[model samples]
Target: MLIISPQTCTEGFAYDRGSRRCIDEDECRTQPDVCRGDMQCVNQNGGYLCLPRRLYDQPYRSEIPARPEATAQCLLGYTPAEDGSCDDIDECETNSHHCNPTQVCINTAGGYTCSCTEGYWLIGGQCQDIDECRYGYCQQLCANVPGSYSCSCNPGFILNPDSRTCQDVDECEDEPCTHGCFNTYGSFMCNCDEGFELASDGTSCIDLDECSFSEFLCQHRCVNTPGSFSCVCPPGYYVYEDGRSCEDINECDTGNNTCTTAQVCFNFQGGNTCLDALQCHSPYVEVSDNQCMCSAENPACRDKPFTILYRHMDLSSGRSVPADIFQMQATTRYPGAFYIFQIKSGNEGREFYMRQTSNVSATLVLSRPIKGPRELVLDLEMVTVNNVINFRGSSIIRLTVFVSEHPF
Candidate 1:
């Protein structure tokens, strides 16, 4: 025998024999008159709703009229209490207000209001974020946050305690520069010491290359140190006390010359030379270390010099014109005597001139500018005449001049 159990259905549901299941009943269609004249029915899965007909026609009304079918009368956002009196509904507590997330909801008598929260403002019926930065809150830099602003400063400045202005940061206190530092309005500057210069990084100091800046700063070579510069001369020279000029070392007087006992050491600008003692030819006698004398009685020395002397001198090139270089004076000054001076030879360039300075002395003057390394041999002759006694004597000096290559 084949038998089937009878199925049971809950309220608002009916058993279907064709599909073998229980289906929900359409209450709105099954009972068209279930609602009142001013109300309509809406079907749900397990129940039905009787809403005002006006709610279907005007869904966005600002004011909702009280329902005549309710036990107590109340406006929108209000509910009836146990005493049958309308009470204010807390839309915020109930989470039923249509306010923005950033707005606050407050309940009133039979209604509710929406307002912007902190850090925001209500504008044109909408909540807007307030720009605190637009109010000039920060002096240097301002960063606008959601509802406020943050104050900042520039690189070399610091924000003040009030957070409205910027103050200069004293980088000098931190010793940012190797030598010195200066603080300005909003920044700091680095400075170097006497002979140093600021580096590219603006925080360090480096040696100033004075030599590279000007070649004439030193006479010979310029040496740069940490904070100073030095003018250096060669092995046989020395620097002037108050300047960068190089002077002759005078190795002969300094006892640094490599000359034998029989040789004489002559010092020049940067070097020394050794020479044999002066040699007197025939008819002449050695009167001094560098002088030779000849007697008037010797016929071979009639036209020749009665006395001959040798002299050596060193000079820097490009000397000033008309400079008094050498002076010749008679050893004995005799009353009523006359003397004359002249350059016998070695004036090919006419670079020298002589002027009588006194009755017994004469001076040799340079007439033109001459550059060297060069050597000039000048034969200067001085003639002395004593007409009262009929005496005439002449002296010759062989002057050898060495001009250095440099002026200093």
Candidate 2:
């Protein structure tokens, strides 16, 4: 019904040069630029058709034309494949993940997942070591290991079967110390015995100098040695039974003095002294080197009885001494008792008189006088009025009788 030139036909239609009429035109073959970039052009009767291109696969949409000066890019976490489709990246397996070595990696939608392994936890996106010891799991200390935890004990302790408790070890069994060995967990120590001390080496023993201090024990001097000391006395003294005490030597009894024959050596504490021996004068007779009696002056002195000697018997080294040594004070040891004193034996029986009474103390008294120097021996005993067995204490006494000076 209408005749139109090729240029006058609607878009995508062409004028048939042979029929002299308007007709469909293959615009897709003739003008490739006529369709949109994201669409394909198809030939139709008297026109052309445009359709969207097929998408490659998932994560990819239908073809979309990019704006000016912009490129077509896939969404975040997706990349283009060989077929121009978008595919999610497996960062977990592709070595593109940010997970720590101690963490586990998992692929997620559009991203990756990171999780910490055992004995570790996430902190600031990184796996941090877990401190199991902080929770009191171990008695002393704890350490973190890969995928697990470990327990430890302090020095001088040993881990128990539970791995959480600690126990002390016995180092003394091996005698590591010279005297005593103390064992602590993970360590051992040594100690010295009595009178000794630890050395600078920490394990050896050394002697202790006890005399270094100001404790003076010796009578004259103190001699110090390893772990012990001794007391020393002067030349005239000797060490007593007790190691630290000193006693004097009896020079007279031991015959160690320098006295002449005419000099008599008398013993005293700490030393000895000599005295001159006297000779009897006229009208006086020499009883011995040390004494004389005036038997010639009185002439009746020999007629005097020996009973007079007990009155002034001497118990001292000096002649004509008093008899105070024969006296004793009896103390009452029992609750109720009487003290009695008597002579048990004598050189001449009944020659001396002794009195016994129900008193706490008694003594033998000499009321008579002697004509010359004499020696007397006696034994005494003490008893309770009830006759209970009580041994008499023992002591020695020397006695002498002297006629008055020149028998005055």
Q: Indicate which candidate wins on TM-score.
A: 1
Q: Estimate every model's Cα lDDT from 0 to 1.
A: 0.78, 0.58
Deviation from truth (RMSD, Å), model 2: 25.3
lDDT of 1 by residue, 238-321 (tens): 889956988788889989888999999988887778979989999999999999999888898888898889999988789888
Q: Pick the candidate with the highest lDDT.
A: 1
lDDT of 2 by residue, 1-408 (tens): 234455544444567888865565677788867787777665544345565543313234335764454444665457765555567888987989876776788786556667656565555556676566555667787886654567878766779999888887676676777667887657788877766889887778898876666555665578877667788776657889988766768898899999998887765445565756666554555555544555523655433211111122332122242333345445446545565566656636344455543366655655344333234656555554444554223211223332222111
Q: Which residue pairs collide, candidate 2?
A: 156-184, 156-185, 157-185, 308-369, 311-366
| Regions of model 2 farther than 4 Å from truth | 1-91, 95-103, 106-114, 122-129, 135-139, 143-181, 185-191, 196-223, 260-264, 281-283, 295-408
Q: Lowest-lDDT window of 10 residues in candidate 2?
A: 304-313
List candidate 1 segments past 4 Å from native: 1-88, 93-103, 108-113, 122-128, 137-140, 143-188, 193-196, 199-207, 225-227, 332-337, 386-392
Q: What TM-score, over all chains together, does every model reach?
A: 0.65, 0.39
Per-candidate clash tally: 0, 5
